[model samples]
Target: MASNRPAPEAPFIPAQRETETFGYGDHRTDEGPWEEWNPTEDSVRPVRGRHRVAKQRGGLARSSTVLGVGVIAAVGAGGMASAHTGKPPVSLSMPDLPSVGSLFDDSSASDAARATTPTLSKVGVTSADSDRSGNAGEALRNRIMAQAEQQQSKADSKATAAALADAEKQSAAAAAKAQKEAAAKAAAAKEKAEAAAKKKAEEERLAALAKEYKLPVVSYTITGTFGQPGSMWSSGYHTGLDFAAPTGTLIKAIHSGTITQAGWAGAYGYRTVLTLDDGTELWFCHQSSIGVSVGQKVSTGDVIGRVGATGNVTGPHLHLEVHPNGQATGIDPAPWLRDKGLNP
Candidate 1:
C-alpha cells in the first residue's frame, strides 16, 4: 500500500528571513505593494516579532560574568576578614584604641605617681607572667636587703654585748677593791680602839702614883679649864690649870722639891720650876715675881712666887702644871688635885 506523506520535518527549521522597515511621519506600506515578487514557502518564513529561540548558554558571556562575580566576591571576603585569626571581622567593627595612649601623660597626676612612673610597664604589653616575674625579682631584692640588715644588727648586738660584759667586769673589780678598802678601815679602827684602851690604863696607873702628892698653890679659885680652847696662849688650848688668886699670895711647894727652872717665859710669864726628889717637876706660872732661882735648893712650905697678871696674862691667875720628871708633856691635874683633897 502507498502513503502520501512528504519527507519528515527536520530537527531545526532551516528557513530564516530578515526584514527591515522605515517609517516617516505616520505613513506605512502594506503587503500588496510588491517591490520584488517571489513565491516559495521555503523562501518565506513566518514574520517574527517574538520568537522562541533555542535557549543555549553563551560560553564567552557566561565566563565573563562569572569572572566579574568572582572578583567582587573576593573583594567582599577580603574586606570582611578578621583582624586577628581568632577575632571577629575587622571591616565589620570599629577600631580599638591604642593601649599606650591610656597613660602617656602621667605628669597630670600627683607626685607619688610620678615617683613610681618608671616602674610601670607599657599599657597592654605586660602579661600576667611578666608581672609575676617582676614581683618575684622585687621580692628577691628586698630579701637580700633585709638579710644584710639582719647581719648588721647581729653584729651591733654582739658589740653591745661585749661592752656590757666589759662594764660588768669593771663593776666586779670595783666591788672587790671597795671590799678590800673596807677591811683595811675596820682593822685601822680596831687598832685605834686598842691604843685608846692602853692609854687609858696608863693614865689610871699614873693617877694612882699621884695620890701621895699635895697641891702646890693654895687659896686659889680655878678660873680657866686645863684644856679650854682659846687663843690667849700660843697653843689653841690652855696647856695648864688656871687658878685665880690675890696678888702677893704665899705660894707653897707642892712637894719637897728643889727649884729647877726659874725664868720669865713668854706666855707663862715669871715661871718657876721645882724638881721633887722623886724626879717630878712642877711649873708655877703667871707669877708677880719669883722668890726662887734656878738650881736653888727649896723644900715644901717654902714660898716660890706670888700670883699676879704678868706677861700675856688676862687676869691675876697662876698657871700650875705637874710634869713627870723633866718631860715637856703635862698630865691632867684634876685627878692629882683630887688626891690632894682639893676639887679643881
Candidate 2:
C-alpha cells in the first residue's frame, strides 16, 4: 500500500546554504553558528500506513545500505558494457520484495522467497520455446514412420497381384493342355472304331458269297497260288491256283456251265474248258480222265474229271485257270473263286 507522508529531512545542513541561528544554544564559528540536533518522530515525519519501514536493529541498517548501493552499481555497469559493445541489452527482472512480517521478524521468510524465484540461464530462450521445438520433431518422426508403412503396404499388394496372375496363367495353360490331349484321344478312338466296322462288313460279304458257289476240289491242299514267281511255270509267274490231292480225287464242276472243249491240250494234258453263260471260261487242266463230252451241259457240283499229273506237274493236283469273256489271257482263279463265294 502507498503512503501520503512526506520524506524525512536531512540532519546535516548544506554548505551552499547561508548560516542561520537556531533557538537551541548557539555557538559561533568563522564559518557559521551550529546547534546540536537530535531527530525525533516529530522532526523526522514518520511514515504512515503499510508503506512504513521498520526500525533497523543491530548492524542491519548499514548492511541494507551497502546491499542497495552494490545492486545499483552492478546494473549500471552491465548497461554501459552492452552499449559499448553494440549488443542488445539483457533484461533483468527484480524479485518481489519480502512481506513486512519477514523484515520485522526472522530471516527465514526471505530465504524461502529467494529459493522459489525463477533464474534465467540463457539470453532469449524459454521453456515454452523448447516445448514447441520438441513437438515439431515428434511430428516429423511420426510422418516418416507412416510413410514407410504405406510404402510397405503398396509393395505387398503388388507382389500378391503378380503371384495371382502367374497362378492364373499356369491354370489356364494346364486346362488347355488337357483339352488338347482329350481331343487327340477322341480322334484315335474314332479311327479305331471305323476300322473295326469296315473289317466286320468285309467278313459278312464273304460269308454271303460262300453260300452260292462251291470250291473245285474238296479236302485238297492249295500247293500253289496264282501270281507266284517261279521258273517252273511256263509264264513269268503262275497264272492259276493248284489244288493237290491223291490221284483220282473226284473233280467237280465249280458252277453250272457248258463243256466247250474236252480233250487233250498239249502242255495242259487232258484238259476240259467249261464256258459259263456269261462267256467266262474255266479251264481244268492236268486231269487224269475227262467224264464229260464237248457241248455237254454240266450243273454245279457234277463230276467233271479225276485229279492227275498227266501234264507238266510235279505231283497229283488239279490246276484251274479263268478267262473273262473268252479272252486268251487268264486272271487269278483265286479271286474268281472268291467272287463265286469260295475261299480257294
Q: All candidates: CA RMSD in angstroms? A: 26.9, 18.5
What is the model-wide C-alpha lDDT for candidate 1?
0.64
For 1-344, candidate 1 gives per-residue lDDT tens digits of: 44332322323332223253221233222211212222345433434443322221222223334334544554455344332233333221111222212233344453444444432123222355356557867998999999999999999999999999999999999999999999999999999999999889867865654554556565888887777898766778887788898888877776677887898888788999888887877888888988888878876567788988887887888888878777888876776667554566
Clashes of each: 0, 1
| Candidate 2 clashing pairs, residues 3+ apart or interchain | 209-341
Worst 10-residue lDDT window, candidate 2: 27-36
TM-scores of the candidates in the order shown: 0.37, 0.50
User: Which lDDT value does model 2 have at 245?
Assistant: 93
- The lDDT leader among the candidates is 2
Tell me the TM-score of model 2: 0.50
**Alpha-carbon deviation at 158 in model 1, angstroms:** 84
The local distance difference test score of each candidate is: 0.64, 0.74
